[model samples]
Target: MDTSRARRGSDFARLSRRVAEAGLLERRPGYYAIRIGLVGALFAGSWAVFAAVGDSWWQLPVAVLLAVAFAQVTLLAHDLAHGQICRSRRTARTAGLLVGNLAVGLSYGWWMDKHTRHHANPNHEEHDPDVAPDILLWSRGQAETARGLPRLIGRHQAWLFFPLLTLEGVNLKVSSFRALRRPSLKNRAAEALLLVGHVVAYLGALFAVLPPAKALAVLVVHQACYGVYLGCTFAPNHKGMPVLTAQDELDFLRRQVLTSRNVSGGRLLDVALGGLNHQIEHHLFPGMPSVNLRRAKPIVRDYCRSLGVDYVECGLLASWGQALRHLHDVGQPLRAARRA
Candidate 1:
C-alpha cells in the first residue's frame, strides 16, 4: 500500500478503537423509541386533520404538515437501511419496506441499492450515482461537455437547484416504480404490490372525502413540500464537499470524511435533519444510530485534525451558500460556452 493509505489505515484503527472504548456504538433503544413515538404521532395526527378538515382552506396547511410527516418517516427508513434501528437485518428490511414503500411511497430495495453504492463511493465521479454527470454537473468537465437542454440547465443550475427540489418527491415516487420494472431487483412482485397498495391508499384517502379539485390541490401541496423537505436535508451532506475521480484511492476514513460536510446547529436542526447535520461522523460510521452521531462528532473531528485531514463543518445557511457556490463554479464553463 502507498504511504498515505497506510497512514490513514493506522489513524482509522486508532479512531475506531477510541470510539468503541467510549461505548459510542451501543444502541440507544430509548432514544429510538421516543423518536418512533413522536414521528408516528405526528404522522397520524396530520392525517387526522386532513380527514377532519375535508375541503376547507385549512387543508392547505395540513397538507404541508402531512408532507413533513412523510419526510420524517423517510428518514426513519434511512436508519433502518443502516441497521441502526434493529439488530436483525430481516426486521430492519421489514421496517424499511413499511416506512419506505407503504408509508412514503418509495421502494426500500431501490434506495438500499442506490444508497449503498453512494456510501461505498461517495462523490466519485464514475461510481457515485448521486453526482452522476448529467443535467446537474458536479464537475466542470461535465459542464463543458454538456449538450442540448442539459447544457441549458447546466448554465443556470445554481439558480434552479432549490426551485427544482419541489418536484423531487414526485421524482422519487416515479423512480421507485421504475426500479420495480427491472429484472434484477429481488422480490420484485412483493415490492410492486406494496407500492401499488401505497398509491391506491394514498390517492384513495384524498379523493374519498374531498371534491376532485380540492384533492388535486392537496396532492400538489403535499408532494411539493415533501420533496423540498427531503432535498434540503440531504443537499447539505455532500454538496459543497470534495468530488473524487474514479482513479483516486483513499483509505475508508479519508474517503468518507473528505467528501462529507457537516452543518452546525442545535438539537432542533438535528431533529429536523434526522441527525444528518453530523454528516462527517455519519459517513465514517454508517451503521451507527442517528442519535449516537452527535455524541461521536467531536471524537471524529479531533481525530481527523490530528491526522491533518480537513474536516468540514459550517452553519446551515453557510453550508447552503457553499453548495450553491460550488454549483455555480462548476457551471461557469457551460455559461461561458453558451455566451460564446
Candidate 2:
C-alpha cells in the first residue's frame, strides 16, 4: 500500500512539473489587468445606462446587460480567490471582497472556503458539498434516501434544472448572507458590512434613477438572468461526471481528471464560460490563469491519453445533455416507486 501510494503521488508530481515547465502555471498579470478594467467598466457603464434610460422600457435590455456583467465580475472573483491573477493572499482576498461582496453581493470569504473544499474533493459524495444531496439529488443513493423537497421534486429535476437556475441569482445572495452568521467565516463583520452596503447602494441607485415599478423589474430581470448565467457556466463542468465516494482511491491527477468534463469551443466560448470551458485543465491547475487554461488543455489532454486515463471533452450543448441525463437517471428509483 505504501509503494502504491508513493507511485500515485509521483504521477501528480510528474504532471505538475510538465505544467510548470510549459509556463502555463505562470500568472498573467497583464491579461487580468485588461479583464478587470473591461469588466469594471462594463459594470459601471451598465448602471450609468440604467440611470440614463430612467422610466423607459429600454431598462429591460440594460438589466440583461447588467446580468452578464455580474456573472463576469463573479468569474473574476473566482480567479482571484484561486490566486490565478495575483499571488498575494491579502491582495486577492481584499479584491475578492470588493468585487464579490460589494459588487456581486456574494460573500468572498464564504465562497472561498466552500470552493476550496470543492476543489480538494470534487464530486466526492461525502466530502464535496457540490455533490451532496440538497435541493436536487446527484446520486441514486441520495434520491432513494431523500425526504421532503429533494424527494418530491427530484423525479423531474432534469426538466426543472434550468428553471431552478433562474432563482440561483437570489439564492447566491441569500446563501451568502446566511453563511455570514457562521463563526467559521473569517472577517465576518467586514463581509457582512460590504454585503449590506451593496444592497443599500444597489437599491438606492435603482430607485433613484427610475420609478418603483421599473426599479423592481430591473432587479428581477438582472438577478434571474445572472442566476441562469452562472448555472449554465457551472453545470457542464461536473454535473454528469463520475461521482466519487470514500471507498474510491485514486491519485490526484486521475481524481481530478475523472471527475471533470470539458466543454469544447473557441474564443467565444472561452469568453462566455469565463475560461471554464476548459474545466479539466482548470481543476487540475487551479492557480493557472484563466487565459492559460486553453493553452494548457491540449497539453493536459495529451498527457492523460498517454497515461490511458479517460479524457472527456464534448460540445457545450452535449455536455448539458449528459448532465441532465445523469439527473434524470438518478431519480429513476422515485419514478419507479411512484408507478408501483
* Candidate 2 clashes between residue pairs 3 or more apart in a chain or in different chains: none
Clash numbers, per candidate: 0, 0
Candidate 2 per-residue lDDT, tens place, 1-340, comes to 6997787678878888988999998888899889999999999998888878878879999999999999999999999999998878998999999999999899999889889999999999999988878898999989889999999889999999999999999988999999988998999999999999999999998888888998899889999999999999998999999999888988889999999999999999999899999999999999999999998888898889988899999998999999999999999999999999
Best by lDDT: 2
Q: Which stretches of candidate 1 lie over 4 Å from their true place?
A: 1-4
lDDT of 2 at 276: 94
Candidate 1 per-residue lDDT over residues 228-310, each given as its tens digit = 99999999899968899967878889999999999999999999999999999888888888988999999999989988899
Off by over 4 Å in 2: 1-5
Model 1, residue 194: displacement in angstroms?
0.9
